[model samples]
Every structure is written in C-alpha cells, then in structure tokens.
Target: MTANASPRRWLFVLTILVGSFLLFLVQPMVARMVLPKLGGAPAVWNSAMLVYQALLLGGYAYAHWLGRFQIRRQAAIHVALLVAAALWLPIGIANIAPPAPGQEALWVPLLLIASIGPVFFVVAAQAPLMQRWFAADTRAGDPYILYAASNLGSFAGLISYPALVEPALPLAAQSWGWTAGYALLVALVAISAAARWRAGGEAVGAEAVADGEARPALRRQIHWLLIAAVPSGLMLSTTTHLTTDIVAMPLLWVLPLGLYLLSFVIAFSTMDRLVQTITVVAPAGLLSVGGLSLLSSGGGSMMIALSSLAMLFLVATALHGYLYHLRPAPRYLTLFYLIMSAGGVLGGLFAALFAPLVFDWVYEHPLLVLASAMLLPLPALFPWDQWLGLKPRAARWTAALLVAVAAFACWKMVDGWTGVVADVKWWGIVIFAIGLLVIGWRWAFVPVFALLMLGVGGWDTVQESFSGMRVRSYFGVYTVTDDPEHQQRRLAHGTTLHGLQRTEAGKQLEPTTYYGHQSGVGLTLDKAEALAGPDAAVGIVGLGAGTLACYRKPGQKWTIFEIDPVMVDIARDPTKFTFLSECAGDTPVILGDARLQVANQPPGRFDILVIDAFSSDAIPLHLLTKEAIGIYARAMKPDGILLIHISNRFFNLEPVLAAEAKARGWSAAIRIDPSPTGDDFSDLTGSNWVALTAAPQRMDALTGGIRPRKDSRNEGVWVPLEGRARFERWTDDYASTLPILFWGNIIGDRE
Candidate 1:
C-alpha cells in the first residue's frame, strides 16, 4: 500500500468512528430529556433502538444511491443535509407535554421521532455511507475495519452515558454536551469531505463492473440474515433472561448489551486471536453458565451468576464480529446491512413483542442459549480421517454409550439424589468434562449436555414453573412455595416483588401478599365499614393468587378485571390458593384489558377499585391514559376511592400520578410502607398505594380512618382527568418503548 493510501484508510476509519460516537451518544441524551415525563422502563430503550435502526437504514439507502454522484457532488449534498439537521438543534425535545397518562404506547414513539428525527437520521447514515465513500476515494482499502470502529463508538456511547455522562450531569446539561458532540462530529465529517475533495478525480467514479464480478447469490444473502439474526436476537434474549426471568436488574440489562457492542469492537478490530479465543470458551460457558442461570438464587446470588453469563454474550458478540469481518464489499455493503438489519429487527420483535404473546414462558432466554450453542464455532476434537479409523458401527455404539450414561446420571442427580447428596459435586464435574469432550468431537453432544446440564439445573427451574406452583400473567410471574416453618406465595414482576403471602389459619385467606392486610389496601379494607357498607361493590383490576379475596366480607359484591386469563386460572384453581374459594366464592373474574372491560361495565358499579394491572415490567399506559381514567371514574360511585399500585423497580411513577392529579381535580394522598424483612405477620407485608377520589370528604374519611403520619411532600395536587387530553396516549395501536421511563441521570445537567 502507498503512504498516501494508508493516510486515506486511517482518515476513513476516523470519520466513521466520530460519526458513530455522535450517533449513539445522541440516543441516551434524547431519552434522558424525555424521561422525567415518560417514566423509565426497558421497553422505552427498546423503542429508542428501533428509531435509531430505522433512521440508519434510511441513511444507508441514501448513501448507496449517492454513490452514483461525482465525489464533489456527494460531499456537497451531505454537507447540506448536516447543516439542515443542525437547525433544529441545541438538541432537545420540543417543549411538548408528555402524552396524557397511559398514552405512552403511541405518544412516546411519535414524540421521540419528532424530537430527534433529523439529527438521528443524518448521523446514523454516516458510518455505512462514509465507509462506502472511503472505498471510492482511497486507492485501496478494505473499509470494513472502519465498520469495527463505528461499533466501537457505539460501545463507547452506551458505556459512557451510564458511567460518565449520566453520573456527571443532569438532563439539561446532557443535551448541551450532546449538541457539542454533534458539532464535533460535523467538523470531523467536513474534514473527511475536504480530504475527498482534495483527492479530486482520484476518487474512483462508479463503474458498471461485469456481472461475473457480482458477489454472493441470493441464497448466501439469506444465509447471512439467519446467522446475523440469531445472534442479535440472542443478545436481547440474554437480557430478558437475566433481568426478567432471572435477576431483573439494571446491571444485567446493561451487561449483555454492552458485551454485544464490545464484541463488534473485537470482531472488527485488526485482532483475530482475541475473537477466536472468546469463541472457543463460548461453548463451555454456554453449557455451564447457561445451566447455572437456572438455579433459583433469589435476587442476590442470581445477580452474580448473571454476570458470569456475560461471558456467553461476549462469545455471541465475537461470532457476530467474525461475521462483520467477512462482510461483502462497499458495492454490496447496503445489501449486507439490509440483511443484518432484518435479523436485528426480527430478534427484537421476538424479544419485545412476540415472546410475550407466543409462549407463556419467557422463551427469549432459553432460545438465545440454544442459538448461541449452534452459532459459536466448536473445536474439532480429533482429525476427521483418524476418527474414521474406528469402525463406523463401533463409533456409533460409543456415542450411544456416552449419551445413555449422561442421561442416566442426569436423572439420578435430579431425581434420586436428595439434599446435600454425597459425591454430587464430583459427579457434576465429571459429567461436565465428558460433555465438553462430546462437544469437542460430536455436535450431538451439544444437545446431550445441553439437556443433561439443563436437567440437573435448568429443568428444575422449568419444572418449578408448573401451574399452582408458578404463574406467568401479562402482569408478571407469581410463585407459591412451601417450607418447614411457613408456606409463602410471592408475586414477582421481572425480579421485583409485587406481593408476598403467608399462611393464615392453614388456609390462604390472608390478604398480605401484594395488598397484604398491612398494606394501604389492607388498611382501607379493615376500615371498609367507614369507607362503604357491607354490600358495597368492590373491583380489582389484577387478582394475583386471589390474595385480596380474603378481605371480602359477607354479602359484599366483588369483581376482578384481569387481562391474562392464565392469572385468573392460577388464582382460582384450588391447587394454587383458596383465597377466592374460602373467602369470596363467586368473585367475578373478568377477562381482557382493564380499560376495555371497565368501559363496558355499568356506571356507578364499584365503590372501591384497586388498579394493579402490570405485565412483568410493562406498565399498561393505556390503562392510565386520560380516557381510561374517565371510564374508571364513571364506573365508581360519587364517594368511591381508587387505589393505584404503582410499585416498579426502574421508575419513580409518583410524578406521573402527581401530574395526572394536578391536571384533573381530585383529592389524593400517597401512603408509603416499607417491605418487612422479619417473620412477624404484621411486619413482613409492606406496600405503596395512591388513593384518589373526586369527593374530598370521602378521601378525608379514608385518611382519617388510618394511622396518621407526617405530611407527604411527594404527592401532587388532585385534578380531575378530562378526556384523553391531547398529550400522547399509549394504546395497543401504536406504542414504542424508546422514550425511557426514569431516564433521570442520562440527559442533561442534573446529577
């Protein structure tokens, strides 16, 4: 390569690197700005990714089309686009109020696009486009190394936002910081364009190469899509498994995504050895750590094991990186990326949308593990020809022996073995070693140990997921377990506890789970006489294990509106819990979304409605929208009170409720109770409930009936919810999780 050629290649890499950094940094920066209004959640981040990818595809297509232009013309056109995008900047959302309560499904995505569309679209395209330009301008270069740099910038952006930017600044300052970064990116692009302009006629013009020069056929492109899609999907799947299915913590979510980005860095860099080494270790880790993920360590140890699982993610990343290394030339770059994007979108759809609908279980996690095992390159145990030295029949018999032994040992370990069984550790270690050998020589051993390890560890978790023992509703998973001292039933939404139940009088009529007797719901129910008469009609939006049914009094009418029929079945079945059978034998369990169900209900029916509908980490914004609020209000009596269970791990929803209360005239107060860690019946149950009422006198009655505490500064004003006030309303029709909920520290100057 000529000295001048080397300079051109480096310059190309630098341009892509700068462009990528700006591209990714802008995402969190914009998300942070809207978080105070949007609320924080994983879905918000997912939606943001979609926005970035969509705009990226658009930019790449534009760059591909522009390749037909003379170098000077392309530069001029791009510079104009950059300038036009900057006009809307200082980089922030427009001064628009958030979608009305519960409109997040629609308004959040729309608002995100409106706020950052131009800037994002322009920046996102630069990587693929600039690399193609480099291939045109540089006398000779791969341009793919620059692809690696772009992803490195992406990794830097994701890591820097949480670790450096968010911790250092508030939302407002973050916006300015990003604006500064965008200006720098613009400067970098200008420098490259200047270089290309100087290169002048040397910038190779597009040529119609012979059809013989064409690359992979359509079949190969489709193959590339599957390879790319599976790993990309697995990355997200790992996140779901770690957080929702296993440990549901921020670190878990960030680790897998971080590793994924880092993998691209390793894959694209001039380092082949690092990528190869990670892939070799990947298979062993997938089998071992994947099995470990199945162990129920509650919250603490599960977090540690989840971190270990990051190794598996790194492996997947390495494999994906290898794919990029083999990526086609600039002429076919867009096609390669188009396929890549399709895979990414499909994976995301499965994780975010379809998985919730298709399987009652969180299938993403296991599916990802399976995909990783298939994709990661396995080590060859022996020479192919040497293996043939053994008779074919003998080889087959030996393979069968290994399988039988592994299967039998697995069965004994799980079924025959009891607590703290002797030799269990050694046995497991030996089995793992044999499995590794099998993975080395035979691909069949992959599934063999996959099932073996899964059985000894993973299958246990799966079996524990049986009906009556465990429940997965749109809201989340609820588990009931028994011990020597006491029996307990717990409700968990993505690693966060929603409710817990303790044995009462040998029958589970204790309303001490999520809405335990000690909770705000319990406190109100205890004073049911003062709030309403015995025949008062009570409504509950979510009926988890029927814990609240125990609070029913004789002749009192009760109804439940639940979206997931599975949850109702779990709670009502005698095997799960008898909260309904023993308390309210005829508790009307209504199915479907609460908003639609409540709208269809008779007006002035419920005197007290407890709103507790949530699917795992999903907060049904539709249910809380202004329109839904009106339906709720209409369904209740004049003096009725509404209890909203707003407990979530990732967001501070109080402000949202405060905004609603301020917008709509109503009397409201927040009751705060910490979860009990002790064994005492009264001490173990805790909850936070917000009570709203149009009648101040009625709210006063409920408040007066409870133990008085210090005034709350957090609770905002009470304002009646008008119609679905024109803010964004999140409906099933249109929802994007991009505008992160509680993206507090990531945006501007606030720390």
Candidate 2:
C-alpha cells in the first residue's frame, strides 16, 4: 500500500506473468518437437500433460516448503534452484532416438520428463512463490488477485503457440526463444530478491505475525481438492473427446487448455460481477452443452466440438470461481496452490494414465461430466419438505423411482427413432422433460440429466461393452461392428471407417473403404506391376484391416510397417476381415513407426511404397514432413512410385504434399476417388490419394492420356499441384496445419 512498495509489487507480478507464460509455452513447443518420434498419437500429448501436472505438483509442494523460511532465505534458495535448472537450457529435447516397438507409452513420458523436467519444475513454482514473497510485504495488496495475471499469461502463451509462435519460428528457434525467456525470468527473480533484501528483517517479522492466523481445517482442504479436480479432469477429457472423436487436428488441443487457463483468469479477476454471472449461468450451460456432447455421434461435429468447449469453459469458470470463494488468506497462498496442483495431478493421472486401461470406450468423458455436475452448486427448484412433511424420505425415494422410470421410458422411446421425424420428436420431448426437471425438483435433476446422457451415448457404450465390439488402447479406441442388413462388417477408428468387409463367403478378399481397386493407390499398384513386372517389391505404411493386401499378387513381395499393434492384430486375424489371410497370407509385418522403419530398409528395394496410416480424420503430420519423404524416396527405386493416402475430412493435404514434391524434384499427381453407389461385395467410399515419383516418365506412364486437373474436388482424375501459395514444405523442425484446414461448410461433418 506504500509508495516505496508499489514498484516491488509490480516487479513480482511481472516475474510471475513471464514465468507462467514460459511454463505453458514450452508444453506445446516441446510436445511438437517430440510428436514425430512418438508416432503423433493424440495420447502422446495427454501423456505429456500428465508429466507437466505431476511436475507442477512437485513445484507447488517445494514452494509451500519454502514459505516456512525467512524471505531472504526463500529468495536465496529459489535463485539457486533457477540457476540449477538453467543447466538444461536452450530447451531442445535430448538427442535421443525414437522409441522401439511397444515402447512408445513408457518412452514418451520418460522423454518429456528428462527433456523439460528441471526447467519446468522451477518455473512452475513462480506463481505461488512470488505471491508468497509479495505477501511478506505487508504494504502489498491481496496476493490472490495476482493469480489472475499469472493465468492470463498462461492463456496468452497457449494461444500464441498455435497462432503465432509455431508459424513464425522453427522448433530449434522456439527452444532458444524459450531459453531466452527463461533467462529474462531469472533476471526478474533477481530484482525481486534484491527488493526483498532491501526490505530487511522488519518485513520478515511482520510476515510471521500474519502467518499466525487460524489454518483451514482438513475438511475444507479436501473440499478444495475435489473442487479443483473436476475441472482439471474435465479439461483433459474435453481435449481427448474433441481431438479423438470430433477432429484430430493437432492445434485443436490448445483450445480447451487455453480456455481452462482463461477460467482461472476470470475467476480471480477484479471483475467479480462477470465471474458471478458466469457462475449463475454455469448450470444451464453444463446441462445443455454437456448433454449435446454426450449425444453427438459423427453428426454436427463442429457444433458438438464447440459445445464441448463451451461446456468446459463454463464448468471450469464455476468451479474455479468457487475455489476463489474458498481461498484462504495470503499467508496460506502456497499451501492453497499446493493442494490445487495435487488435485490436478490426480485428475490428469485418471484421464491420461488410467482411463484407457480401465475403460473400453471414452467412458471417462461422461463420468467426469457427471462428477462435475455433482460438484457444481445446485439450486433447490421445488419445496419438497412442504409437500411431504410427514414422510419426506419416502416421498423423495418415490420421486427418485419415478424419475428413473421416466428416464428409462425416454431412453426406450428415443432408441426406436429410426426416422428423422421420429428423432426430432424424441429430442424435443427429451429437451422439454429436461426443462421440467430443472424447475420441478433439484435432487432429481442431476440423476435425470445423467440418465439422459447415458441414454444418448452411454447406453450405446454399454451395448458395445456387452457385445465386446470395442477395444481401447493407447493409440485410440477401435470398434468392430456389423451391418447385418448389408451383410457387411466394418472396423472403425474413432469416427473414421478404417475398413469394411462383405460377409459373403467368397467376398472376404475384396478391398473396401479407401482402398477400393479404382482408388489412386489401386491404380498406382496396377501401374507398378506393369512397370516393374509381377514380382515387384511393395511396402505399406499403415495396415488398416489389411485392405490393400487384396491387391497383392502371387510372387509379389509385400511388407507392412505398422505403429499400433492393435491394428496389426485386427488386420492379421483370419476371423476379423481376412484381407491379409486371403490375399497376402503370412506377410512380413514390421512393428514400429513407418518413418523410422522405412529408413532402416535397404535402398531402392520397393517398386512402390504406400502410406495409408491416417486415423479418423487426423493425418500424423510427422509422416508427411520432408524428412519422412526423404526416407520414402530412399527406400524406393529410382523410378518407383510413392502413394500417400491424403484423404482427409478436416485438412486439404494436397498442397502440403505438392510443396514437398516441388522441393524434392518429384512429379506428383492426385486422384479423388468417387464413392460407390448401391450394394456390392466391396463398399467403396470416397478417397483422396497422391502419387509422387522421382521419374517423370513413370509419372507420365501412370497418368497416360489423363490431363492433370486443377480442381481438387473432381473425382477419379490426376490433379496437378498448380496453386502453391498456401503450401509450405513441412519438415521435422517446422509444420503448421492451420493453413490447410478445411474451411468449407462441411467442416466437421466427415464421412
């Protein structure tokens, strides 16, 4: 409050802001750097998040311990820790090779921890520690408000990475930029330390008097932990749901995280009215948007994604605002953050580490939604006590039973909606019932809401579980479902159909989905046999039900490089689809990432190489980088062709591959395959494929009389990579999908 202390207070705020910014910025930067090595699975980012949360807990604990010491001693110890952490500076990942087969899950966490552990841990303590240090100065105002500044920096950092930092700087430059920022943070810390030293022993004695206040009870602390845990778990779950099920775009991960941090900013800001308003409306937002998220099933994906994000922000703002309400005095600031961080670690552990192992579907998403509902401050909508004064317990139990029955009836009714009109009517009825429950009885509201959510999606998951139709692994969830009407079995990875097989006795060898015989890869295979004879050596990158294996002829040497063992199992099993068993029987399947595996192969071994490893709509960007292209070129003969399955619902990848082809002096052509009409042995879907060959004559032979067209939407024609302004040559050190993201009306409506 004094004029002399004003400058020191601002200094502490600046230090905390800069430290928090660097803390969040490094998360995406380092994750991007390691993405290629880890096979670019979305789970890799989740694992990285778990490590960050665990380290944050460690940092908060350390800060709480430091709070026990005098201001001068605390400053000295923190300064030493910062200096020690600087030894791992420049911030690039350690020069370690990619993990071998079956080692990615263990290696990803270890790599992230070893690469950024010390620096991250040291910086993670800055917010609480700096607040504690400022609190020691009795003249400084309430230190809780400074938390708003910290998270604002975090929000800025997360958004900046995807929007500005990634587009402007390569990975190495990003690392060095972070290192420079770290150095600036150290300087700021030093200035704060000097200010504390100048305050002398009087300030320390004043701090001891303030620290003698009554401590929060154990029960209150546990409440704080639970309050914090729900939002933390919800943040990760939202990220997983959007990226895995809705859109597999890499930068989409930042939206939920940025909003989660922004919630802290809103909760702790000076704008109390705004926070209060959001808290008031939070319940309605959770029910409406959360219900929609649960009901979402490959339709209105953009709306579903936006709704899920809105739900996360609202739930987080309400919970964090409640945490703000329960915040202890300045003396207990570090302890408060310590408990909150511990809760965060628990939430992250459950979502990122435990959920996949325990659940067959993304059950964590709905379960966390229900938990958030329980934690939220609910309003009493009806006077139940007045209505049933004599036997209130019996009345409540009877009401609960009735609500359950109503929910079951609604579920059965909705399940019978096989027509669009019937579906619309059922949704209208469900919404009307939800509105009644919101006003009729508070106790029954959450249970009914939970039941509706279960009815929409949870019941489907239970069915899948009972039927053993789904399996969840670290890579993703795979579902095997049958369409008895069409006599077809399909393998789906998330929302994208990986492969489809006809159930007729002799039709098992047919190729479906993106691998139909008329597809680009198919045409390329035909040309390969014509050019290199019947015994041409071929390699396939992604094995999805081994659909492309049907194109293999006798005496043709075929090999497969697959990153996920689960996919390999599905493809190899005779009872599954039999594409591999009937076509390329006992084929040699190399287990590892294609980028690494292909590099290990002999030079000029394959006549053609096929890269078909897209999961859902997400293209593992690592496989499309320039270095990956080089590996493919090395493994192919001089005139060999490289076929990349660039079909995507969210991204237009032709430009990216075109740029790479232009840079590498390879001739490239694209084909957009048409979807098959009517029922047949093969259920062909629309697909996009790109073929690149180092030899122009080979490209010419494949293209023949077909002129290269400019329009990408045209079907079954070789498209030329004419317009190059939007394309950037992707490399291991630099790649951005923002430019090529599909901006059409059909944004999230992927087939």
lDDT score of residue 488 within candidate 1: 66
Per-prediction TM-score, please? Answer: 0.70, 0.92
Model 2 off-target regions past 4 Å? 1-8, 96-104, 198-211, 292-298, 381-443, 676-682, 710-714, 723-727, 745-751
Instruction: State the lDDT of candidate 2 residue by residue for 1-751, as single tens digits.
Output: 5766454677888998999999989998888888766666656777888889989999999999988878788889999999999999988778667677668778888889889999999999999988877766766767788899999889888888988999888998998899999999999998888877755322422324455568899999999999998899888888877766776654576788889999999899878898887876777777776764554354535777787899899889989999998998777888899999998888888888899889877778888888877887665344454555737676667667657675765566467534455664576456536534453355676777676676555555566687766788877888888888888999877776778888877876777777777889888886667868889999999898888888888778988998788888888778777888878877899987788789899999999999987776666788999988998999999999999987776778878888988888888888887777776624888888888999998888887844657564667788775547756689999998778777773454444
lDDT of 2: 0.80
- Which ten-residue region of model 2 has the weakest summed lDDT? 200-209
**What TM value does model 1 have?**
0.70
